[model samples]
Structure formats: C-alpha cells, structure tokens
Target: MAFTTVPLTALGAAPWEPNTTYQTGDIVTYGTDTYQCVQGHTSLVGWEPPNVPALWSKQSSPADTQPPTAPADVIASNVTSSTVTLTWTASTDNVGVTGYDVYNGSAVAGSSATTSYTVTGLSASTAYTFTVKAKDAAGNVSAASAPVNVTTGAPVVDTEPPTAPNNLTAPTVTTSSVSLSWTASTDNIGVAGYDIYNGTTLAGSSNTTFYTVTGLTANTSYTFTVKAKDAAGNVSTASNALTVTTLPQNSTQYEIIGYFPSWAAYDSPSFTPSNIDSSKVTVINYAFLDICWNGRHGNPSQSPDNPNPNTWTCQNGDGTVNNAPNGSIVLGDSFTDGTADGGYNQLVKMRQLKNTNPNLKLFASVGGWTWSNQFSNTANDPVTRGNFATSAVNFLRQYQFDGIDIDWEYPNSIGVPCASGQTCQRTADKANYVLLLQTLRQALDTAGQQDGKHYYITIASSANSSFLADAGGTSNWLSNAAQYLDWINIMTYDYYGPWDAASGIVSPLYNDPANTNGNSQFNINSTVTNYLNKGLPANKLTIGEPFYGYGWKGCNAGPNNNGLYQSCSGEATGGSDGSTYDFAYMQNTGLLSADSTGKYTIAGQGYTRYWNSVTQTPFLYNPSTKIFITYDDEQSVHLKNEFIKTKGLRGAMFWELNADRNRTLQSIVSNDLPH
Candidate 1:
C-alpha cells in the first residue's frame, strides 16, 4: 500500500508521541502552537490534532483572518406552526467550513453540520426572519446569507375530545394484574392515547387500547374505566366501567432470582441479606467470591503472575486468614460476611427457609466484573481448573449454600481492566471456558451425590453474541457449555452506557426504532430470541434486567426526539456520578414518578419521562439540564415477566436488590412468576 506520512519529529512535535496515552487537558505542540486534548485516548499516528477534532482541539494559534463565503439561496421548508426547517447553498471556505449557524432575527436558533437546520420551539401565529452563517474549525465566521421570512401557521385548537373507549373487557387476569382492552375511540384530530382509571384514581395510560393494570391483590375485584385523549390536552368522558377479579397464585416452577452483592452494605442505606424478602425469590445469587492467585485474592492490577501487591485479605467468616492456592475461591469481603452473628449467618438462615419453602435456595456467585481478571488464567490449565472446581464445592458446603454461580465476566476478554488499557487472556478461552464449566459441574455433582442434594451451576453470560459465535455459524461455545449448566443468565443490561457513542436504553425489551447508530440488536427481545434460535432451550435462558440506568449528561438535543438516541457531550453528572442512576435513586430524586402499580409516567423532577413503544421501556430527559437517563421501571419489569412466560423462558434476574424502592421491582417478579 502506498502511503504519505509526516513524522512527528520532522513536524517539531516533541511531546506528541505516536503511542502515548494522554488524559484530558494534556497539551502537545505539533509545529507551532500547542493543542490541548479534549478527551482521553491512546494517540495513534492518524488520530493527531488535525485529524480528530473531537479528541484534540487547538488551544491557541496564530490567528487566521480568512473567513468562509456566506451561505447562498436560503429557503425554508416543512414550516409548521412551531418549527421551521431551513436549507441553503453550501458556503466556500479556504480552511473548510466545519458547520453552519442558523440565526432567527438577532438570536442564534441552532447549528448544523450541513447547510440545513431545524429551528424549533417557535410560538404559533408568528412571523420570523432567519439567516445562515458559515464557520470554520479555526473559529472563523462568515457573512450571513440573504434573509428569508416565514409566517407560522395558526395554533391548533381542538376543543372536542375523542369518544369514550367502548367494549371494555379483561382478556386475562392474574393475581397481581388485569389485562384490559377496548375498542378505539374516535376524535376530530385523532385518538392519541387511552388512560385507564381504577375507580376515579388514574391507574395508567397506553398508546394502544390495551392496558395492563398491575399491583392488584389476589381474588380481589377492581373496577376500571378508560378515557381517550389527544395532543391538544382534550380528554373524553369515561368509558363504561368493567369489573374483574384476579386469580389466586398457582404452583409452578420458575426461577425468580435476584443478585445480593456483599458490597451493597457500604451504600448510603446499607442493604444486607437480612433485608431480602425470602418469599419473593427462588434463589439469591450472592455476589461475589474471588479467586485466589498464589495464595492471595487478585486485585485490579493483575497480569500473568504479575499481580498487584495491594491485594484484598481473603479470610473466612470465622477470622481465619486463607492462604489459598491459585484458582481457590476466597471471600471478597470477610467482614461483610462474618460469623453466625453477621450477614453470613443471614445467608444460612435464608437457606433454612427452604425447609418451609422448597423453592428457596442460596448460591455463591464467583468472579464478577472487578474480580474476573484471574478467570482466564485459572481456566487456561487443568491444575487450576480442577483447583477451582474443588474449592467451589467446599465454598458452597462450608457456607451451607445450595449451589455455585460462576460469573466470569468474560472468557476471551479482559473486561473491566481493558477499559484502562489492559490486555485480555486468550482466544482459546472459547473452548477452555466450556472445559472449566465441565470441570465444576462434575465436582458439584460428586458433592451433590455425597450430600444428597442437587447443586445448580449457572453462569452470568454476556449479551455480546459475537464472543461465542463464529461468523455465519452456530455458537460452539454455548452448545458445548449448556449441557453441564442449569441455566445461562444473559446480562442484557449495560448494552449501552456512558461508554457508548449514543445514549440508548440500558436494557430495551424490543428493537428500538429511534436507535439509528446500529445497536438495534442490543436489546432484551433480540437477545432472548437469538439464544432460543441458536438451539439453547428457552428454559435454560434467564433474561437479565437492570435496576440502574445509563445516562448522558449534556445531550445536543435536549428533549427534541425525547433526548434519546442523540449525540451527547459526555456522561451524565446527575445525582449518580455522571454515569448511572439506580431505580430507587431515581424515585428518591423524583426523576421518576408513577402510580404504585401503573405503567404510566406521572412526572419527573425537571425531567420529562418518555416511552419507547417498540422497546417497551421508559427514559428520562431533563430539558433544563440536558441529561438523558435510560432505565427499566416496574412497568417494564411487569412486561418482561409476561414476555418470560410467553417465551417459555426460565425466568428473570435483576442486577441487585439495593437499586429498588419499597420492593417495587421485586414485588412485580414475585407476583408474576411462580417461585
């Protein structure tokens, strides 16, 4: 390949190393003036100051006076009452026009990368004059284009509301919810949506005629009515009321699992094993135990035998220091799980509850995101893998846990460490992971036979299917691994987060229509369906839900397009550290508000809540702050529980318990699924 390149030394760039990892605000000089780094990234030759404008911005420069020519032939189209879409001929610039700024009268309306811009939030029955100006990257502005006058249409005033929803009927009734559907209502403008009421109190709203009113008691009668409304805030009279009684809970086998992390005890309001509602779940995955490397628990600073000296003290609840060998399971935090008097005792007590309820079981989950660095090394060899399996059995038996859950964050990838420039283990992990699982399964079965109990083996699998599958073929990894496992908990959350380019739903139920950046497959529905299609039995797949949401702080479009699937300046700096906010935290801060058992959004604290009809999830956007947060609420969990039943899947599993408020999300799972 022919190439034309300039060396940094030749360009008088001393500090700008080709492979240097620079933080934000780090400055480097290329030829003359110093350029400041806008974002942290490893510098490549092609991604220099002049190439990536988003990463490196020119700090100070020898001022250039040349400006781009004015934009020509400015015209307005799609002129609505509240908006104007304008376009103009491209402006010529010697240094290249970076973007065009649109001006309405004397104020700046908006800016666009191309010659077109959409100026919104205009008052109806108004006249406006608009102009366009071209600009370059060097902070150069051009002369304005010829002005274009536009007259806004008269405001829409629809006084007449839609007719009352007819044929109100409950097609299905569960112990906790009622699925109601009615005929569409007619309106002059159009029927926008329907709102269901529980005897005058607003229960919920739905775009479609059908609404599922949840949080009802078993064998209780609840009268519901529906009303139609339009965009003009016109609401129709209530429909004829329909009364329905819910069915009583039935006996069926479904895994209603929840993760109980040991570190949640350090939160603002600490959540321990004692806080768990024993009746709400079939199993509690105790996260997490660590794998000891050379008689010590591994830390974030880990490599092949080059582990950090600052390691965690792995000890038993009885105050015994564990000098465990490689691959042996060790307590992540010994204090959190103390003697028979502390949280560890609570875990054992929860296990004994199975005497009264056979469904309840306790499992020890190992190797979470932070502790997964040693998983690859352990699985690389037979000696380590065997050590892991044997120690796993002892860990479960000693703690009186019923099972073991391996949460090797990723097999062929060095998950969290790689985020800070660390390398993952190997591609051979594709096969070795299955070998590791097979090893543990055998050990667990041997122990189960001796103990006269069946020990479950589950893995917290990633939603990234490419990690397991070959191009245009079956996932050899899952096929080989599924036989020895009880179930695969697909981590469907965190599909998009602060690390993502577009601020999308953390765990979308279905395909998102608004997601144009090509992660449409990163959704709950697609992930579950893909697993089933790949011959993994639905019963062995557990859908994962997120209690915490991913956020974008300063979105380019505030509430336009609902601040979703939009380009954002960076991570959100909401109450949570500019990255995530739990569902409980959201409720506490009023970023979310709804009826106890309803799917409809009531309001938010300076943030507007919007729903994605296709994804079947809710998101929040604060227009004033320009922060967007995507999270799953009780309604989404209710819908997902229904999806779980419809798909004949094992059940649902959320990230952790502390992220919920007043057992909001847990109650939904307990009421819907057979525990």
Candidate 2:
C-alpha cells in the first residue's frame, strides 16, 4: 500500500476525547484575557497565574464575542390541569440562532426556540414556576428569564372510570402478588398521570403505564379503576373499572427446610430456590442422619474428634468394648470407617429427609459389611454387648434418630470380617447373635425410660445362604432376636453373582435352571419365604431393593449361546466396589435413560441392557455381538414394590440413599411404599 500526503484542512481537528470537550466557560484574565478553548487540550502561552490544569487558555479570536445569551421566558396559560403550557422567545446569537432552555423551579423542564411548549406530567390543580434561557452554538448560556409562576385549573374529575380492564383475573396462582399491569389510556394533554383505585379507594398513582397491586386477599374478587390526567389538570373520565379475583389462599403451601452434606453450595446464602411453593408435595423427606462414623461433624470449631465421644471412664470391661463417653456426637463420617468425628454422608441425608417430612422418622444404621468386627464380640458376651448397646443409646440421643438399624453381614460365617472372633468363634454364631439383640433391647429400653420415648430397633440381614445356614435351614437365632426388634430388612439383591461358578444372572427371579446343583435359590419369592419360614412376621419385614446392579464375566456367542450373557461375559468388567454410579452424575452429564416399557438402561460395552420388571433386576444382551447387560430401573422397582405390598411387608430400604438422590428410584418407591 502506497502512502499519500493529505492536506490538514481535509481532516477536522483530531477527534475530541468524548466528554473531555469542554463547553464554553468564563474568560480567564491572566496578564491579558485568554479565551477558553472548546477542547480541553492546552494552548501553551507564558504562564501568568499558574492555575489548575483544567483552565486551558487560547488567544481570543475576533469571532468570539460572548456567544448569544440564553433567552428568558415564562410558563403561560390559565389551564389549571395536569399539563402546563410554556412559552419563550428565541435567543439572539452572533452567529445565528439555536435553542432555548425552559426551567421548572430551577430544573430543566422544557426546551426549544419556538414560543410555546406543552409540558405534560404536571400534577392536576398544582402550581408551578418556569423560566427560559437561550444558548448559541458557541456555548454561551443566557441569563435565566424572570420566573413566571402558573397555577393549573381544577382537574376534571373522571368519576366515570375509563372502561374497566376486561376479563381481569387473579387465577389461583402461587406467586408473591397479583400484578395489575393495565392497558394504555388516552387524554387531551396525553395521559399525564394514572390513578389506581382498588375497590373504589385510591390505592396510588403512577405516571407510567403499569402497576402491581400487592398484599391482596387470596381467592377474593376486587374491582380496579385506572384514571388518566392531562396537562391542563383535566382528569380523563374514569376508564371502565375491571374486576378480577386473587388466587385462592395457598392452601397447601409448604417449604423444604433441611440440610445435608451433599447439598450443593449449601454453605452460601444464594443456594435457595427462587420460587418456592409448599403445597405440591403432601410429604417430604429431608434426607439424612449421621449415626456412626462422624468425620465431618459440627462446625469448624467444635467437633467430635476434638472432644471425643468415647472418653467415659466407667469401663464396661471385656477390653474389646468401645464406649461413647462424651455423649455428644455429630453428623457425617468419613467415607469408609466409623470414627469419633461425625456421622457419614448417609446420616446427613436421613436427617435432611426427616426435616422435610415432619411425619417421617429416621434410624441410624450400625455395622455395615465394612464394620462387622464389633458384632461377634458384642454378641457373645453380655458385658461387651452392654457397652455396645449403651453406645447405641448414646448415639441415638446425640443424633436424634428414631431408632437404630443393625446391619450385620451375617450371624455366622458369611463375610470375611466375622471369621476370627474369640467370643463365638464356632460355626454356632447364631445363638450369640440372638444374645446381642436381647442386650440392645434391654439397654434401649432403659435409655428410653430416661428420655421419655421408646426407641425402635431394626436389623438389616442378608437374604443369602449365610444368614440361613446350610441346607437353607432357618437359624434358631431369629426366634431369639425377633421379640426385641421392630422389623428386619432383608437384602434381596446380590443373591446371584460371578462368585458362582458360571457367569449368570446375579439377581434373578429364579436361580438359573441349568445349574447342575439344583440350586433353586436367589429369587424374590424365595427370599420372602426364607424370612417367613424363619419365623419372621410379614408385617415386621421390609424388603431391600438395589438401586444399582452387579456385573459378571466370561461368555461367548455362537449358533447356540451359553446361558451366560456374552456382553457381561467379557472379562469381568467389575461391578461397583461399594460405590456405584449415582443419579446425580446421570442428570449432570445427561446420561440417564428409561426404556419404552419403563426400564432403565445405561450404555456399557457396545450393548443395550435393560432391567427385568418381574424380577426387580437388570440384564443386558447384545444378540448381534451376543452380549448381555441388566440393571435395575422403574420396571424392576415396580415389581419389588408389588412384592412388599402383596406380601404385607413393612416397607423397603435401598442400600444407600445417594444412589438415586435425584429421585429416579425414589419416585418409583414412593408410589409403592405405604403413605
């Protein structure tokens, strides 16, 4: 690109920095009078009175006589209405003519070089003073004209309100107020003001178009009139009034008021929902209660670990016992182990649930698969058992649970943790387990007397062979423990697994018929029967349904495929190790899916899998690739709920609440559980 020389005149002075271009001001007499430059830019000359930087000076130009002074004028006319008429003469300018400034009591009200201006928005029957000043392009403001006071005539009354708003309505809404934004109005001086009448009484007035009338009775009808006023203080004849009713009183309005560790951004005030209505849900479950394993407990200053819940000096001997000495406990524990600090995430959720649902009750669960070491010792000896029971009481008192739920993996040899205890090391661990329950019952009873409330005791037992002993025989242990417990929650999900010799259905309606051992086990019917056969009252048993599923491995596809699902057959992809994917992740990542038949599915290894409604289970099968996948979904949940209702079961408890915190499984379960 070649450069071309440009003439100076071709371009206007360098663009003035916006707003920096100063308007004309008084001349500065420094040695000799120096004219003020329109641009704030400096015009250097010998300094006479070194002043502040803003006072720039330039030699006076012959063309600069004080620019035309603003012309003076007054608001005229006898109209005593909402509108006022103002008139002023054009200001004389040396260069030519420009505009005039009309003031309403020293404030700019109207402007023009013409002789008249209709100032709207004046109050009806109000008095106002206005003055005018003329200005020329050179930036000279003329002296204000003499003030002219004017009084508006009495406003014409619009006793006949403008046509009332048509079809005004206050639909039974749940919002904060009923808005009264209305249609526009016409007037002689234009609608200067609008008077809003609520049921014939003046509520207020606004110059603008819309208004929201608040604090009105719900489900009640009221009439409203919006009247317009003009510049002459003449009020328009009232628009026809409109009638509308307010929403019916919030009959069922309610609010969610509880907290859990998992509540996103709960530590901040902004986490609350913008619009809340309490009437939608007949019941609510706040979600958590920390029973044991208090890791993140209380606030930053006071915590269980800092003071310890187990410092009581009165030792219940049998050195194996762990006592809760302080009696003070907290909510939330670390992920794996039970500690002195606080309860776990599970407890937090339970507490929150109770807060939302006033009629709801919460229970603390003790001894999961990971914490079974204390069971055998507590079960065998009365002293150690007493300590355990006392600890349970202390926990309940501190955390506010309705009861305690015992989740021992098994009474005898089943899980690995209970394998080596000196107390009841034999295969006959069942009898010892019963003793433990009796001790808990007695202790809870004693504590209940002191607290004025009887505490409930429930157990979560395995539905598999281990709890039942060899040959599917009911353990004599149940007969002993039944009297002390409120109910038993039987876990029926993980009955079948890769632990079996072949890769087959982990949770099935029936054991694989092809099993050579004639093992007709692992079905909902069988599990329910097992509990009932063991002397359990149907009304005192709650079936446990899994929100997640287990996976298996090792299978191939061919003309005649083996019973093992080929997709699940590929080297064991590994089921969750105590941590299954949750619905929170499903919603956040948009990965949730429900089949047409209402089965839930998630993509795995190139195969589409569906849960079985009849079995309350899931399975996958890729016929082309010969794969099988299955997981639990709404269909499966429905089947499980039916089992609870038909069998007259107390209710159902999911393994963990977090798995479906977003309510995927809960929505289904809620429909099935007793109201």
Candidate 3:
C-alpha cells in the first residue's frame, strides 16, 4: 500500500522502553510503522515492538475509536443491612478497559478497576437496583449492564434484650468493700457488659461478669443486683438479689501488700515499678535486699558454684573492716554516669510514683527464697545483728524507703545453697530471729526519731506449724516478734508443688478431704488458725497468696478426684518447678479459662476442670496428655479475701505482683480487703 509520510506525533505513537510494561490501547513506534500493544505484558529484549505479533499488532491509526462491550450477568451477594456486594461479568474493549462505574438507580455510587464492587452505607430494609458501566482508557464507555435488585436485611432491631445474669453471689465482703460475681447473660447477639446496682442505685459497671463495689459504709447491709447489656443499648432484667453485711471496722484498716521481684526486669514482660498499680496495693515490697556477713548490705557478688550467679551469699566475712554504713542498694542493672536503665532502675520510678499515691508505701524486703541462706548467720549473734540492723537503717534511708520487710524464708529450716561451712538452719535461729527483730526495731526507731517519721518493720514468716518449735525450743517467738514488728506476712502458699509425687492445689483456702498425703494442715485456714492460736495477733497477720501456679505432667487420670491428688510421672511443661507459669502467662497464652459453671479449664490444652467444694479450689486434668495443673483464679482469690475479712486479719499479700494477669488477682485483693 502507498501511504504519505506521517509524523510520530500525528500517529499518536510514543517511544517504547524495554523495561516498561504496555497494556492494550498503548501505541508505540518502531522504524516507520505504528504498533499497538495487543496484550498486557512486559517488554523483553527479544520481543521488540516489531518482533512479536501476538503481543503487538500494526495499527492503522493510534487513536482508539471503539468502546468496551456491555457487561453481562450482573448479580449481588453477601448483602447486609448497610452494605451489598455486586459482581458482574467483565466487559471487553478493542483496546483496554480501564475502570468500571457502579450506579445506584441513575446516580454513580462508586467506581472500581475490577468487575466486583461493594456498595456501602445503604439504608437498611430498603430495596435498591444497581448497574455497572465499563470505560476504556480512551474515554469511551459501554452501555449499562443488566440491573441487579437487592433488598438489604432489616435493620437489626435488637429488640430482644440479653437474658438476666443469674447466681448473683458475694464472694468477699469487707468493712468498706464487697466483691460480687454472677453467671454471664445470654443474648441473640453477643452481650457487651454488665451493670451492678446497690439497691436501686447503679453501683458500677464491668465488661466482665464480676464487679467490686467500694466506698461502702462499714457494718451496713447492702443488697446488690446485676443486669446485662447489649451493644444496641438494650438492657436486660435484674439478676437475683444478694444481700451481704460488711464486717465491723477494725481498729487498724487491713493492708494489701505485693512484692516486686528485682529479677522481673529480665523477664519477657519486663515488669517494672512503673507497671505497679498503686491503687491496688497499700505497700510495694522491693524483694530480696541481701545482708552480707562482712557487715555490708547489698546484692551478693557473682559466684561460680551457684546456678543463679547473682544470688546472695554469706561467705568471706572481714570483721576487721565494717562495710555496714557504706552498703549500696544494687538494682538489676547499673548506670554508668547519668543514663536510664529501663525497668531495672525501678527505685527511681517508684520514688516518682510516691507523689501520685500518698497512701502507698514502699518497703525494702530483705531475704527471700534463694537469699535466705545468710539469714541465720546475720541474725544468730548480737554483734552481727547489731551490724545488720545499723546497715538496714542506712540502706532504707539512702533508698528513700518508708519501711522494711524481713522475708526470712524460715528460722530453722534449710533453704537453697546451704553451703557446708555456712551456719544455716541453726537450732537457736528462732530465739535469734526474735533478737534480730528487736535490734532492728530499736535501730529503726532511733533512725525514725532522727528523720521525724515512724519507719515500719514487717516479716514474712513460714506457714508451717513446726516452724516456731523448730526455731525455738519452747520459746514464744511469734508473741515476742509481734512486739517489734508492724505485721507478719504469713507465706500461706507453696503448701504443695511438683516436688511431690502427686499434683495438688498450690494454695487452697480450706482443707481438702481428697488430700490423703497428710497435707490437710497445710491450708490457709489451718495455718492462720495455728498462728492465731500461738499468740499471734489477728490484726498483725497478713495472709500471703500466690500469683502463680504449679503443674505436673504424665499424671494418672483418675475419676475419684478428677486427676487431683493422683500420682504424676513428672512435672508439666509450663509449671514444672513450682512457679513456672505466671498468671499473666497462662491467661495471655489462652492456656486457662474460667466458665460460668464455677469450673476452670485449660483451654485447648487437652484438659478438663474440676471444682472441689471441700477445698474451694479448681484443678485441671487431661487423660490423653496426662497433664495436671492446679492454679488459683478470680473465684479462689475472692474466697481467700473473704477468709481474711472473716478472721479479722490485717489483710493479704501476694508473693510477686508481676505474676498477675492484667492486675486481675490484685483487683480482687484490693476490692475485697479493707482499705
């Protein structure tokens, strides 16, 4: 064919690149002929503009004059009250179809590059017709597709309110606080939350089924009811009423104390003093301030023999030179000059929080599970005790601590790493412990006079009844120690652990008849009763609870106690060594859950929950996996708080605060105990 010379601009052809992708309708020039892309493909080295016919075709003219064919089979699916999804067969164009316009009646609702489009924000319960139009890159448009009719579902009326929460019960009632719980409500839709009422007044609201009512008058009778609520603002009828009378206000309001472990800074969650909820606890005990035999008060130097090299020890004492007055408060990590050490620098953060909570007190707790090896050497003699007491006062003042908590694991019992040459668990530990407290009290009082403030002193005593008799032969150590101490934090947990051949509840509030292992006397009630009977004032005793639980693996599954108190071959994966799994770890990992039936379950972990009425505790067992887990949940914690109020005890204390899941267990302690 004969043709006149035409310029590249007249042909509407642009230069092509080897790396660029060209779709249909894109015209490119090679030599003199104008070529259009017949398919969407990337330009290759060999597949030049004139080399590939399937990808590129010679065009008579570069301008696209044809429009896309009309779409077909338009339909709508997945329709909702406010939205509808529309889909149609894709339209075809001589060139390339660029986009599609979706229309509601005659108005353009929206546009999309694909055949499927979703129309949103439509009025519910209304019928609507939708159509689509396809457009090419050259601005040519196709005819409208077939109309698709769709009527959105009725506006979810949500007229049916949730069923009322049932089994309203008061788990703990104190002079000024009460903890309540009920079975969750049912609804056509999911329930949102619950509202608690005192008589006819709304007391509080909780997302969960449980609520704690605070600021109530002491010794007053109050009736409570719970009502369920839905997202649509629908409220259910009131639950069964529960009437409870608060206990008489004691001379001194009970205290809720929690220990903040120094090593928690190294954990996965890295708990710091800033993580502490000051409102939930009256005192935060900084755990394990070590005592050196050389008259120094600080953390122990690293040792090769010990598994945890940073653990405190009492070796190599130099009595000639006194390191007492110059003892330093060692944190997890040290600062070089003026740098922050993250959570490890808890002392600085805790001091800052003190201004926010004036009622919250901070105490330095000396000696714990691993560090109690030196307690005997420090407290056995009058000279060492005097030196320790003097250094303790100096340490507390230097750290800006308001008080001291001596957590001597036991007086006459062997603890971890009782070195052969060290004097640990001596027969005279009980008498010496008393003497040490007396000395500390005198020193603290002297320091308090100088500082013009009363510095409190407390102790974490053993729950074992034989502890006193083992420490002192016929000596009333509990009575004698009470004179100098502000309160005694009874270690009521760790009654049973994986060390035993069988799995058992770690912290039962009451004795269990299923415990045939002669562990009936190791419960919280029995232990508290023993201390009270042995001349310990109820007002000066704070029952200790555990924030973690123990587990066992390869256990014998028996129907008698639902695998509880059954022999186990070995320890479980998470809680093998008494405190392997913290409450936060379990709850966050979905390893545990509490149902409305008052039973706790190991969710998806091949275990079933069983509740023991005698012990008022819950246990888990799995026959296939042969795993047994004994742990305390919100229900058990509430019951323990009730026990404390009933006994008129000082209050409650937890072993470590970081172990709790979202401050759930601590909330129970705070709301159930007297403020």
Best by TM-score: 1
Clashes of each: 2, 73, 0
Give candidate 1 misplaced runs (Cα > 4 Å): 1-251, 302-310, 339-358, 418-424, 470-475, 558-561, 576-578, 596-600
Question: Which lDDT value does model 3 have at 502?
Answer: 85
RMSD of each: 26.2, 36.1, 35.6
As for lDDT, the candidate ahead, 1 or 3, is 1
Residue 153 lDDT (model 3): 90
Instruction: Report the Cα lDDT for candidate 1.
Output: 0.73
TM-score of 3: 0.58
lDDT of 3: 0.71
For candidate 2, report its TM-score: 0.48
lDDT per residue as tens, model 1, 70-125 = 99999999887788889999998774565678999989886565567788899898
lDDT of 3 at 199: 98
TM-score each candidate: 0.60, 0.48, 0.58
Provide the lowest-lDDT 10-residue window in model 1. Answer: 302-311
- Pairs that collide in candidate 3 are none
lDDT of 2 by residue, 431-482 (tens): 7676667667666765765787757777777877557553223345574466
Model 3 RMSD in Å is: 35.6
Q: What lDDT would each prediction earn against the true structure?
A: 0.73, 0.49, 0.71
lDDT for position 257 in model 2: 15
